[model samples]
Target: MLKRRLLTAALLIILIVLEILYLNSTTLAVIFAIVVALSAWEWAGLSGYLARAQRIGYVAIVLFLLILVYSAHSFWPTAITVFLLSAAVLWWLIAAYWVLRYQQQCDLLPNSSPLRAWLGGVVLIPSWLAVYQLHQQYGEYWVLFLFVLIWGADTGAYAAGRLWGRHKLASHVSPGKTWEGFAGALLVGALFAGGAAYFWLDESEALYQIGFVLLSLATVVVSVLGDLLESLFKRKAGVKDSGQILPGHGGMLDRIDSLTSAAPFFLAGLLLMGSLS
Candidate 1:
C-alpha cells in the first residue's frame, strides 16, 4: 500500500509540475476546473448525495458557480477575488472550530442536505480561484513553492509521527495524527521557507524573508486543519476513504484537501504583504 501510494504520488507530482511549467494560464485554469469538478463529485458523496443523478447535479451546480465566479473575477478582478478569498479564510476559521469541537455524538448533516452541498462550494471554489490567481499573477514558481512547502510539511509530519508520536492532536477527528507530527510539519515548513527566502531575497530584505517564513509556517498549520476537516466529514459519513480514484490515495479530494485550504490563505498572505501589486 505504501509503495503504491508513493508511486501514485510521484506520478501526480510530475504531472502537476509539468502542467504548471508548460501549460499556459488559460489551459491550466481549464485543467484545474476539471479537477475541481472531480473533487466536487467525491464531495457530493460525502455530502450524502449518493445517487448518480444527485452527484451529477451537485457537480453541475459547483461548475456553474465556478463559471459564475470566474466571470465575476474577469469583470471585477480585484474586488471579487479579494471577496472570495477572504470568505474562504473565514470559512476555514469556522471549519477549524468544527473540527476541533467534533465529537462522536455530534449531529451530522442529513443525507442530501443542501447545506452540505453549499459547504462543498464554500470549500472548493475559493481554493480553485486562489490557485489560478497565484499561477496567473505570481508565476509557476510561486505555485511550485506552495506545493513543495505543503509536501514537505506532510512528509515531515508522517516521519515524526512514526518516530515520536504519542499524544493525539485530535483523536476524535483523526486518531493517527499527533502533536509531535504537527510540530514536525511546522519546523520543516519553516526551514524550507527560510532557505528559499535566503536564496531568493537579498540581505537587505531580511524582514521580508522573515515575514515570508512566518507566512509559510502559518500556511502549513492551516493545511493540517484542512486535512482534519475532511477527516471529520469522512468519519461522520462512515467511510475510510473518500473514493477509490487513485491506486492508494482515496480520491482527488484526499489528495488535494490540504491544498484546498492552504492555497487561499497563502495567497491572501502574499497579497497582504504587498508581494503582488
Candidate 2:
C-alpha cells in the first residue's frame, strides 16, 4: 500500500506539473472539468444514485455547468464571478456547520438525497472556476501555490498524525485524524506560504508576511473542513473510500477533497486582500 501510494503520488505530481506548466488556461479548464465530472460520478454513488444512468446524468449536469461557467469572461470581483464564488463560500460554511452537527445529520438524513446531488455541484463547479480564474489572473505560479498549500497540509497532517497523534480531531467522521495532525497542517501551511512569500513574492515587507501567514492559516482551516466534510459524507454513506479509481488514492474526489474546499476560500481571500492593498 505504501509503495503504491508513493508511486501514484509521484505520477500525479508529474501530470499536474505538466498540466500547469504546459497547458493554457482553456486547456487546463477542460482537464479540470473532466476531473470534476469524475468526482460528480463518484458523488452520485455516495448520494445513493446506484443506477449508472443516474450517475452519468449527474456527470453531464456538472459538465454543462462547467461549460456555462467557462464561457463567461469575468475577472475577480465581477458581479457574476463574485456571486458564484460567494455561493461556494457560503456552502462551505454550511458544510462546516454540518460537520459540527454530524451525528444529527448522519442519523436523520437518508443515504441518497437530492440535497447531496446538488451539493456535488456546489462542491465542484466553483472550485474548478477558482483554479481556472487563478491560472487566468495570476498564471502558473499561483496555481502551483494553491496545490502546494493543500498538498503540504496533507503531508504535514499525515506525518504529524503518524508520529505523535493523540487527541482525536473528528472521532466520529474520521478516526485516523488528530488535533496534533491538524496543528502540523497549520504549521506546515504557514511555512509553505512564508517560503512562497520570501522566494516568490520577494517582498520583505512586514505586511506581506502577515497577510500571507494569515491567509495560509485560514486556508488550512477550510482545507481541513473539506476533508472532514467528505469523510462525513462517506461515513453517512457507509463507504470506506469515495471510489477505487487510483491504486492507493481511492478516487479523484478523495484526492481533491482538500482542493475542492480550499480553492474558493483561498482565491476569495486573496482577492479581498488584493483589493484592500
Candidate 3:
C-alpha cells in the first residue's frame, strides 16, 4: 500500500507540475472538472442515489462542465464568486436541512441507496466550478498553493499523529486523527504558506503581503476542514474512501478532497484582501 501510494504521489506531482507550466487555464479547468465530476458521481452513490439516478446526476455534471468550459470568456472571478457563494449558501442549507429533518435525515443519508440524483449534483457542481476558476484566474502558484497547503497539512498531521499524538482529536468521527496531528499540520501549513508568500508574491505591496499571510492561514483551515468534511460525509454514508480509483489512495476525491473546500475559500480570501484587482 505504501509503495502504491508513493508511486501515485510521484505521478501526481509530475502531472501537477505539467498542469502548472504547460497547460492553459482552460485545459487545466477541463481536467479538474472531469475529476470533480467523477467524485460527484461517487458522491451520489454515497448519498444513497440509485444507479439510474446517479447516471442522471452524472449527466448534470457533464452539462455543468460544458457550461463552465464554454463560458470561459465571462468575468472569471465574478462567475467563480457567484458559484462559490451559491455553494456556500447550499452548504448552509444542507446543514440546516439536516438539522430540520434530523429524524429523516440522520439515518437516511440518501446513500448510493439514498440517491437524490439532481440534488446531489447540485451540491457538488459549484465547488468544481469554483476550483476550476481559481486555477484560471490566478497564477500557477495560486493553483499549486491550494494543493500543497493540503498536502503539507495532511502530511504533518499524519506524521505528527503517529509520533506525538497523546490525545485523540475526534475519537468518534475519525479515531486515528489526534490533536497533536492537527496542531502539527496547522503549523506546517502556516509556515509553508508564509514562506511562499515571502518568496512569491509582489513584495512591493504591503497589502499583498498581509493578504497573502492571512490567505495562507485561511487555506490551511479550509484544507483541514475539507478532509474532515469528506470524512464526515463518508461516515454518514457508511463507507470508507470515496471510491477506489487509486491503489493506496481511495480515489480522485481522496486526493482532492481538500481542494474541493479550499479552492473556494482561497478565492474568497483573495476577494476580501482585494487581491483580485
Q: Which prediction has the highest TM-score against the true structure? A: 1
Candidates in descending TM-score order: 1, 2, 3
> Model 3 off-target regions past 4 Å?
50-53, 56-62, 65-80, 89-123, 275-277
Q: What tens-digit string does per-residue lDDT give for candidate 3 at 1-277?
A: 8899999888988888788668877788678667767777676666666477655666576566557644753656576566555676456446434433442335433444334454445445555666666676676667777777878888899999999999976555566878899998888887887787778765548667877877777677656666665666677777888888877888677787667666666766676666464
Please identify model 2 stretches exceeding 4 Å from their true place. 74-77, 103-112
**Which pairs, if any, clash in model 2?**
none
lDDT of 1 by residue, 1-277 (tens): 9999989999999999999989977788889999999999999988888999999999999999989988899999899888999899999988987775574446444455688888999999999999899999999999989999999999999999999999999888899999999999998998899889988665636777888899999999999999988898898788998899999998899988999999999999999988542
What is the TM-score of each predicted model, taking all chains together?
A: 0.95, 0.95, 0.82
For 58-169, candidate 2 gives per-residue lDDT tens digits of 8998898887776664433377569878999999988887787773435433444788898889999899989998898889888988898899989999999999999999
Candidates sorted by lDDT, best first: 1, 2, 3
| Candidates in order: C-alpha RMSD to true structure | 1.9, 1.9, 3.9
**lDDT of all predictions:** 0.90, 0.87, 0.68
lDDT of 2: 0.87
Query: Could you tell me the TM-score of candidate 1?
Result: 0.95
Model 2 TM-score, 2 decimals: 0.95
